[model samples]
Structure formats: C-alpha cells, structure tokens
Target: MKKQIFGFKCAFKGIIRTINSESHMRFHIVAGIYVMLFSMFYSFSPTQYAVLVLLITSVMALETVNTCVEDLCGLVADRYEPLVKFAKDAAAGAVLTVALGAAVIACIFFLDFNVINTIFTFFAENLLYLIFLLISAVISAFFVVLGPVGIKEKFIKLKNRHLTKG
Candidate 1:
C-alpha cells in the first residue's frame, strides 16, 4: 500500500514537472482554468459537465504524454535522426488533433454564433477596448512563451544591471 501511494506521488511530481517545463502544458492549464470559470457562468446539466471534465482530462493527459514522448525522443538522439523526428512529430500531431477537437467541442457546447458575432461587434465599436484586449493578449503570449519564472528572472537581471550602471 505504501509503495502504491509513493508511485502515485511520483507520478504527480512528473505531471507537475511537465507543467512547469512545457509551455504548451502551461497554456493548456491556463486555458482549462478559463474554461472552468466560463463554465460556471452557464447552467450546464450534469451530463454536460461530465463531458467537459472528460474532454479537459483527455487533452491534458494527452499533452503530458506528448511531452514524455518528446523528452524520450530527445534522449534517444542528441543529434537529428529521422526516427526521432517522426516520433516527435507524431506526438505533436496527436496533441494538435486533440486540442483542435476540444476547441470544436467547446464551441459547440458553450459558444453560439450570435455570441461570437456580438463579441466582434462590441470590439469593433469599442476600438480602445479592443486595443487593450490585443495588448493583454500579447502580454499573455509573452508570459506563455517565457514561463512566468523566466520573465521574472529577466526583469531581475535588467534591474540589477541598471543598478550597477547607476
């Protein structure tokens, strides 16, 4: 029993490491959080919630698997190899397919065409708000590309350099 519990703990640690190391995993996590928050705004039936849970779990799990596969491929070849390329590409393709499927499912379940149109219309009418939204998106993209910790480290380095110059 202790061994089983330890194994589960180790598995969870791996999941955490993957989340920290992989930008796409972090993006998926953020997206999942947003989806859960958005879901609360709607009165989803139990079945719908269950479906959402399943979809979220599958996408996250598949992404973790892809990370593992990519890591393994990297280990298998320090330099370029066709087999490694195929393995990495295949893993990425799997993740992309699942992510796309999840997006379609989300749109079908949560978004209406009219709602999308209204969003675009509102942004069009409110150009300043749209500019702010775009800026926020760019910041988010930077944060996602460089993990939060990486961004903090860069900021700290810049600050220290300026202090030394002064």
Candidate 2:
C-alpha cells in the first residue's frame, strides 16, 4: 500500500511538472482568472460552470501534451530533422484543434446566451470600467512577456560580473 501511494504521488508530481512547464499554461491560468471573475460578477448555472471548467481543462491538457511532444522531438532530433518538424507540427495541430473546439463552445455560450450583449450594455453604461479592463489586460500582457526576460538578463549580467571579479 505504501509503495502504491508513493507511485501515485510521483505520477501526480510528474503531471504537475508537465502542466507547469508548458508556456500555454500561463494563458490557461489567465483564462481561469477571467472565468473566476466572470462567475463572481455574473451568476452562472451549475451546468454552465461545469461546461466552462471542462472546456478550460481540455485546452490546458492539449497544451501540456503539445509541450511534451515538442520536448520529446527536441531530445530526439538534430537541427534539420524532417521527422522532428512533422512531430512538432502535429503537436501544434492538436492544440489548435482543442482551441477551435473551445472557441466554438465559447461562442455558443456567450453569444447564444447574449452574455456579450449584456457586457456591452454594461460597458456602454459605464465606459470607465470598460477602459479600466482594457488597460489592465494590456499591462498584464506586457509584464507577462517582458518581466521574465528582464529578470533573466539581470541575473546573467550579475553572474558574469561576479565571475570576472573572482
């Protein structure tokens, strides 16, 4: 029983690592945050919430699998391997497939149910709030991309200076 528990724990850790390592995971996390805020502001039925959760999970899972495929291809392929290119393309295609499905579901839910209309009405009534949301999204995207690069470069430069001094 102890050994079985240990095996399950290791597998869980591996799954977490795969999800966390994928770049798309960041986007999924942002989407999840949006979902949470939306849910809090707009009362969704239990079924709607369940569907949203499943859709988000499916997209994130596809992204994680795509990352795994890319990692495997990199491990096996040389700089100019045709098979590696094929593998990477196939993995990306899978993610695209999931994304397309998610987009359809989102349209069905948001458009068919007039959620977008309601949001637009709210924004029209309160332009300041809409502007705040747009500004926040822009700032978040900017920091998400550039913040890590700045930190990495700073660390690299600090390490080089330390090495030279030593």
Q: After superposition, how far is residue 123 of candidate 2 from its true place, in Å?
A: 4.9
lDDT of 2 by residue, 1-166 (tens): 9999999998777666764455466666667667656565456789988988888888877777788888888888768788889989998898888878877876666653566677778878898998987896886564445444544687899999999999
Per residue, candidate 1 scores C-alpha lDDT tens digits across 121-164 of 87799999889868866776776788777788989999999999
Instruction: List the candidates' TM-scores in order.
Output: 0.75, 0.66
Worst 10 residues of 1 by lDDT: 33-42
Clashing residue pairs found in predicted model 2: none
Clash-forming residue pairs, model 1? none
Model 2's TM-score against the true structure: 0.66
RMSD of each: 3.9, 5.3
Q: Local distance difference test, per candidate?
A: 0.84, 0.74
Candidate 1 local accuracy as lDDT? 0.84
Q: How many clashing residue pairs are found in candidate 2? A: 0
Clashes in candidate 1: how many?
A: 0
What stretches of model 1 exceed 4 Å from their correct place? Answer: 113-142, 158-166
